[model samples]
Structure formats: C-alpha cells, structure tokens
Target: MPGGLALDTILPSEIKERLSRGEQLTIIDVREDEEVAAGTIPGAKHIPLGQLPERHTEIPQAEEVILVCRSGNRSGRALGYLESLGYKGLKNMTGGMLEWED
Candidate 1:
C-alpha cells in the first residue's frame, strides 16, 4: 500500500467546503437502510458496508470516493478493504455523519 493510503481520511469541514463549492465527489453512505432512513449526507450514494465487496464495481473508478457511516469506525474499515482491492483515491469521512452534522 502506498503511504497516501495511510492518509486516506477527510474532515467533515473539508467535505462541506467541497460540496459548497460545487466540486464533484462521490460520497458513499455505507450505513444500513434503517440508518439512512433516519438521515444522511445530502447527495450521498447508499451502498451499505455489507454490500461493498460484491458491489465494488458500482463505485466509480475515477472519482474521489468518500465512505461514510454513523460514526468514523465503519468507514475506516471500508477504506482498508477498498485499499486492499487497489481502489485509489478512497477517503474515509472522519467522524462520519455524526461529525458532519455537528
């Protein structure tokens, strides 16, 4: 793994700024349907973590993919999996939706 993979984390503030500026990014919510029904980050794609390994190709190859969950932990695990699969430019949204709302 490249050292940059070790740095694959983003703050909610940074994501907010990117969205506000109309920057294109692939924001993925890896939480379950029940969790998403409660709330989610605007414009995020729903791909529950359990489905990632099988649905990996559904994720774009040439985009900055931000993984999110209720908290940062799950997303971090997702990031590791994606990295192991050679997915580039994957970033875990730090503190996930919980921090993003704060």
Candidate 2:
C-alpha cells in the first residue's frame, strides 16, 4: 500500500452518482450472503470473496468494475486478485457498503 502499485479507489458517493446518472457500471459485491441480505447497491452482482477464484471469469475485463464489501478491506483484496489475473478497469469502493447510502 505504500507504493504507487496500490489499486485505484472510488468513494461510495461517487459510485452512487455514476449509477444514478445512468452509467452502465459493473459492480461486484464481495460480501457474504448474509451480509448482502441486509442490502446492497441495486444491480450489483453478488459474488462472495471466497468464490472469486472460480467466479472471477464472470467479470468483464474491458469495462470498469467496482468491487464492494461490508467494508473496503475485502473488496480491495478482490481488486488485487483480479488485477493479478490481468483484469483492467478495476476500482475498490472505498468505505464499501458501510459508507453507502441507499
């Protein structure tokens, strides 16, 4: 995290704004099923962090993708994992769902 190699990040508000503006965003929620049951960004695809190894291929590499979790930690990890596999246009949702409002 000390180097410039850190993954890019987007705030929850920014994501909400983009979605509200009719942007076709690809958001992947990496929280567990129970955590996601509480609520999530509408239209986000649910893929738990544990399942990403096998399910990551389902994500698009050519388009921007936002990763989310209860907090930013898991999503950051998810972003790193996907990046290692050559996926581009990835961003970690800073503060995650904890800072997401509706």
Candidate 3:
C-alpha cells in the first residue's frame, strides 16, 4: 500500500457484485502482459504498471477507475502515482486477482 492509510480499496466481491448489478466499472489491470495472459477480470483494461506514466491518459479521468495487479502492491503504487497527477475517483482492487480468483 503506497499511500498507506490514504489508499482507497474495493474488495473483489464488491466489484463482482457491482458488475452483476450491471454497473459498468472502469477496471485497469496494471499487471504485465505475461501475467495477464494467465487471465484477468472479465472486462479490465491492461496497462502494466511500468507503462502507466506514459499510458495513464488511456484511463478515464471522469469515472471511478479501479487499479488491479497480481496482488495489491503494484496497483496501490499506480493509484498513488495517478493521485499525484490529480486524478480522482481512483480505487485499488484489494488482493488483486489472487483474491478475485479465490
């Protein structure tokens, strides 16, 4: 958790529930391509953590964006970076795919 107490988080179950209810969430998978090849959230966009600085614009600024990774670490860092750039409505998916699959 890069922001520690300031980092916002949403559980995998919560995301699934929202999607089930037809909520169109903006989920960004910050994991690398190889890791993503294994699988990912149903509709999450991939933007590997390292590329975020240059690819951040691809993410929506007006919607609630959920950052996800292998665990929760990288996405947390991604959230912090975006926050520094003044991006709002950002959340890190807690436990990432590991918990998502669980």
Candidate 4:
C-alpha cells in the first residue's frame, strides 16, 4: 500500500486546496450512516467501510479516491484493501473528521 494510508498524517493543505478547486477526485466517507449524519465533507459519497469490499464496483477505479472516517483508522484499513484490489490513486484523509474539525 502507498504511504498515504497512514492516519494522523495529514494531507498537505496545498493538496486539499487542489481538491477544493474541483480536481477530478472521489472523496469517500467510510463512516456509517449514523456517523455521517453527524457531519461530512460536502459532496462526499458515503460507502461504509464494512461494505467496501463487496461494493467496490460502485466506486470508479480511475479517479483519485480519498477515504475518510471518524478518526482515520478505518479509512486506513480501507486504503489497504483498496490497494490490494488494485485501485490506484488512493489517499486517506488523516485525522479524519477529528482533524477536519481542527
């Protein structure tokens, strides 16, 4: 897996800026529906981590996929799985929603 899977390691602000600029990226929220109801990045697609393996087909393999969770831990695991499935352009939003709140 790529080093980008590490939690607590934030993606640089510049990279985030690029994402905000409408870069062709896929931001996926891996939190459960209840957790996402609390809050989520605007426009993010919700695909609970538990369902990712079977639902991988729902996600586009070509686009850059940024995984997010409550604390980034689950997303890191999802990142690894996605990598094993040969999905490229994977990224974990470190610190997850906790850091996003910061």
So what's the TM-score on candidate 3? Answer: 0.91
TM-score of each: 0.88, 0.90, 0.91, 0.80
Q: Which candidate number has the best TM-score?
A: 3
Question: What digit string (tens of lDDT, one per residue) describes model 1 on residues 43-94?
Answer: 9999999999899898876678999998889888988888888888888988
Q: Supply the global lDDT for candidate 4.
A: 0.80
> Which stretches of model 3 miss by more than 4 angstroms?
1-7
Write down the lDDT of every candidate, Cα atoms only. 0.87, 0.90, 0.92, 0.80
Which portions of model 4 miss their true places by more than 4 Å?
A: 1-16
The residue-by-residue lDDT of candidate 4 on 1-102, one tens digit each, is 375444423463544687779876578899999999998887789999999978888888876778889987999999899888988778888778887776
TM-score of 1: 0.88
How would you encode candidate 3's per-residue C-alpha lDDT over 6-97 as one tens digit per residue?
44899899999999999998999999999999999888999999999999999988679999998999999999999999899999988889
State the weakest 10-residue window (summed lDDT) of model 3.
1-10
Residue 50 lDDT, candidate 3, scale 0-100: 95
- Candidate order, lDDT descending: 3, 2, 1, 4
In angstroms, how far off is 26's CA in candidate 4? 0.7
lDDT of 3 at 6: 47
- Model 2, 56: alpha-carbon shift in Å? 0.7
Q: Where is model 2 more than 4 Å wrong at Cα? A: 1-7
lDDT of 1 at 48: 91
Residue-level lDDT tens digits of model 2 in 77-97: 999999999999999988889
Q: How accurate is candidate 3 locally (lDDT)?
A: 0.92
